[model samples]
Target: MKNFIIPAIDLKEGKVVRLFKGDFEKTKVYSSSPEDMAKLFEELGFKRLHVVDLDGSLEGMPLNLPSIRLIRKAFSGSIEVGGGIRSVETCKVLHEEGIEFFVVGTLAVREPRTFERMVELFPERVILAVDSKGGKVAVGGWKEESSTSPQELALKYENIPIWGYLYTNIDRDGTLEGVDTKPYVEFKGYTKKPVLASGGVASLEDVKKLMGIVEGVVVGKAIYEGRINLRELL
Candidate 1:
């Protein structure tokens, strides 16, 4: 079966970088030019892009509109953004700005009512992000842990109009040790909704392994550092 290719763009103060073990304090700046990186991927023919605003992740609202606009334009394809989205108002605006989908992490884990409202209003326009450590959902850039298990909330939203879940292993993100398959396998027998796997992906085999569990996969450090080629994947 064919799977979707979702390239990751983590923005911090207007540049692309990847976090190690979910630490925002110790990010390695991979691309000084996000537009260039996005354009390159678009040129390689990817259908959609996964953009995470690291600053937005912390601030609870989008901080890099200009750069996001540049990336939105550069790709000319679907862009599913996750970061600093804490309100229905914010969701409405970005949705109008041409964002194909929104990924809500911390808010979803804390305020299930808000997430439900978002789904009721936007339907398939939202994607709940599950970035976890030890199978528990981690929010606030992985600094805060919720009592909720990733699978539980995922299963709850299974039939909701939410688009999918972007599953990332906080410990494996930017580690390049290889992609984490444990949490995804945990999701088995739970929800039929698609999962978009993220973090620590270094090669095509990793992509192949995540095949059925995810609707797509987000590649960050690997593509930037040259461990995998977008040309080969897309």
Candidate 2:
């Protein structure tokens, strides 16, 4: 498959923001109206949008549905949502709300059975979030480190029918440093499922470097901070 780029809209307190290294305390608000941001991306010719509920990630449920709803209404395209999606019911609800993909991590690590059932129920709709930090998988909104390695967690769901994997290097996230293709290179060896590289994507060069290795890349800070021009990607 051709590599694609996904623009991210992380919602916190009903505003679009990006956090440094996944730290909530270091968030930088980009837009107050998520709907407008979603519209901008759609108008720019992006076919897919990545939305994360920052409040929901910590609160253990979807708290930004209002904002998300507006986004869904504004953008007539597929939307993959993450953060605080911990149950099968949540997935069903989000699906009804127009979310096409579910980005899940904590549930996959802490509740394997339920996670399996979710995949069984949703089939190719689940996107396993293999978020890495300090060589370990981070869960619980990136607040807690898991005992399992990124590869181990990924391999656990290798056989399960999912959308693919969102492999985020938590350490490099929102840093605008540059892409670290080493981990992603190593990560691809463990599974055949599509992997979407996230974090440290500082320039078009970084995106190009990752294009051949992974199925897609999720870009946020770089696009928001003026480092990356979305039109160029087209």
Candidate 3:
């Protein structure tokens, strides 16, 4: 674990929603305006924000850039976005809109050539999200399974100057069952990339637990449901 980053807000069609292990049908909407939640996170003293476009990513459409930009404007901290960001042009658009980090998942796994090109173009601005279910990497919003493991693909781009890896144990994601720290700790043993954990963070104790494995963990549901505090984190 490492320094505990603040709460992350995941949006789908302008609402704050979280699903169990990336299951779209299993999603639960918490807030109608993600912007409000983001503004609160900023005002509360967080230094970074994780905002995702769940709708756009699953449909293979362009990212929910409007929501992303709105959050950036509302936030005082750096904002990072993932989902539906499949092209260099789209990446640049998010960058220009004040997004400090761009997480590329499906594209990184499904299209290696493009991921390589993006690595050359954006370098540290990009992060490869290795989302997995039962230890096998999944893509297209975790609805499809791939043969590779999170660490396997992480090593492919580990040598590059990309920002880092956003490792999400889909099995533990959004369940609030507790974080699956084993994979994160194991992934850290293989590469030195700064890994930001996604999903399964339920309490401050969990934050303290991850401090020995990676740099930060992105908490979605826990923060939304008043399970954690944002101000104390930053």
Candidate 4:
């Protein structure tokens, strides 16, 4: 199996930024133009991109459609978007706009029936996001904690056609330390679904460690903070 080194573009009010441990107030602005960042990632030969709308995640609805459109128009590579994706209509709108995958959190755990319906409608395009803190799932932009565990949630979708599960460790997010590989290892052990690891990927070595174990790793703050060089990683 081939491991993917995916770059991330977290958008807040149309600008690209990264939040510290999922906190909205503690944000680090990277670039003003998400389109430029997307193009740069494509130019660097990254095959995939992860775009999240921070504002939308907090607001419970997409707030960066224009930015998403601009990034899609600028880069032709595979793009997966998440944040504020609660309804099927939002998924349709994004799919029509050229997004190849939809990452759904909060709603997937809160409303499994609705998420199952979306998976039924868009088979391989939906990616279930299991954002967790203290072994429990976090929702609504990581502000609220849910009773469900990541493993519990992944098990619930065993019979569904979800593309995979995007597991993010909220504590390590944007900290630029190192990933807590235990959860991912445990998650992979429990299910056959493809897993994408996110949060606290601080160096190329960290990516290398996660490589075959996960289908992909989402690297955000490290790249923005110059801790890891994208050109070398690609």
Candidate 5:
């Protein structure tokens, strides 16, 4: 296991921000220039990034396309984008814009057939995002809850040719709490696809705890809050 530590950038209103447990009202703006932040991550030698459009996730359409275009121009590494990508055309557009992977959650749960078609068209470019709260899968930017559990959803798409999974713990997200490995540990048993842990990663030790278990971890609040030194990942 490479223990890939991918940093995250959450965009809201064309600015970089982090929301507490997926609550838009509880947001903290970290930077006004997202591309500059992307460049900094590239300078830190990070090979991948996890970016979400908070506004898009709620509106069901990409509102930060201009900012994302700037970010694409600034960073050379692989980037996975999520939020309001509900159709294949949007995926195609983002792919043309240089995004390597699409982190899809709401679409997959709301319309599995459409999501499958996306995978069929893009192949290894789809990353299933299973954001969970109290063991149930949360959707629509984590504003709505679905009847499906993370395990069931993971297994449902296990046979599909997706890039991998980005499993986030909504309860721990942005809380600065230490990561809970049990959920990830249990989630791993359901599928063969590589899984990336996200939410509430407070320190390097938390990253170390998840090393060799999942494919990687997507950390945002911890890194932006200065709790995690970016260089240490190298």
Candidate 6:
């Protein structure tokens, strides 16, 4: 499989933004147009795009479909979206709107059966988002802590057709400090599934370090803050 350096375009109230450590109140708007950012990522040769509807994640449903639609219209590359995707119906809607993959989070751990059904239906298009903090899964936009550990959760779906896991360190998300590869290494060791690392990617070196262990890495703040150049990174 080809490794990916996916740029994340987080949407909040129709604008591109990034939140600090998953805190909604602590957010910084990077751009007013998500479509422009998506187009730029595609122009820079990124094969895939990671988009999250921050408002939808908090509200328990997709709230930025219009923004997503605009992004799809602007960028022809593969798109993988998350945030408040908790049901099969929502996935179907996004699929119809040109989304290539669905990153299911809150529903994956809280509703395994539903998630399994989605995997069965979508096949390789369903990726599980295992957002973690201190080694445990955090759900509902990182507002609710679950008893499930990332390893345990990955193990539970070992036999399923789910595409892979997007393992994010909630504490490091949008922090731009660096990444802790230990958790990703451990999760991959236990499940042997394709893993995509998210959060704390500060520089090209950070991306290179994670490339060895993860199938891909989702970078946000670093790219927006001009800390890493997408053109050069690609």
Model 1: C-alpha RMSD to truth? 1.6
Clashing pairs in 2: none
The reply for model 5, stretches above 4 Å from the true place, is 1-3, 232-234
Candidate 5 per-residue lDDT, tens place, 94-153, comes to: 989999999999999999899999999999889999999988999998999999999999
Runs off by more than 4 Å, candidate 2? 1-3
Which residue pairs in candidate 1 collide?
none
Of the two candidates 2 and 6, the one with more favorable TM-score, higher being better, is 2
Residue 107 shift from truth in candidate 6, angstroms: 0.7
What is the overall TM-score of model 4 with all chains considered together?
A: 0.97
Query: In terms of lDDT, which candidate is strongest?
Result: 2
TM-score of each: 0.94, 0.97, 0.94, 0.97, 0.97, 0.97
Q: By lDDT, is 4 or 6 better? A: 4
User: For candidate 3, which ten residues in a row score worst on lDDT?
Assistant: 1-10
Kindly state the number of residue pairs that clash in model 5.
0
Report the lDDT tens digits of candidate 3 across residue range 1-234.
Answer: 112664677888887888877888888999887788888876777778888888878876555677777788888877788888888888888878878888888998888998889889988889898887887888897789999988789888888889998988888888888876788888888788789887788888877788868888888888877788665554
RMSD of 2: 1.4
Task: Name the runs in model 6 displaced over 4 angstroms.
Answer: 1-3
Cα RMSDs of all predictions? 1.6, 1.4, 1.8, 1.4, 1.3, 1.5
Question: What is the C-alpha lDDT profile of model 6 across 1-234, one tens digit per residue?
Answer: 123688899999999999999999999998999989988977777788899999989898999999999999988889999999999999999999999999988998888888889999999899989999987999998999999998888888878888898999988999989988888888889776689999898988888888779899998999899888766654
Local lDDT at 87 for model 4 = 91
For model 1, the local distance difference test gives: 0.83
Off by over 4 Å in 4: 1-3
For each candidate, how many residue pairs have backbone atoms clashing (under 3 Å)?
A: 0, 0, 6, 0, 0, 0
lDDT of 4 at 222: 89
Model 6 lDDT-worst window of ten: 1-10
TM-score of 6: 0.97
Q: Which candidate do you rate higher for lDDT, 4 or 5?
A: 5
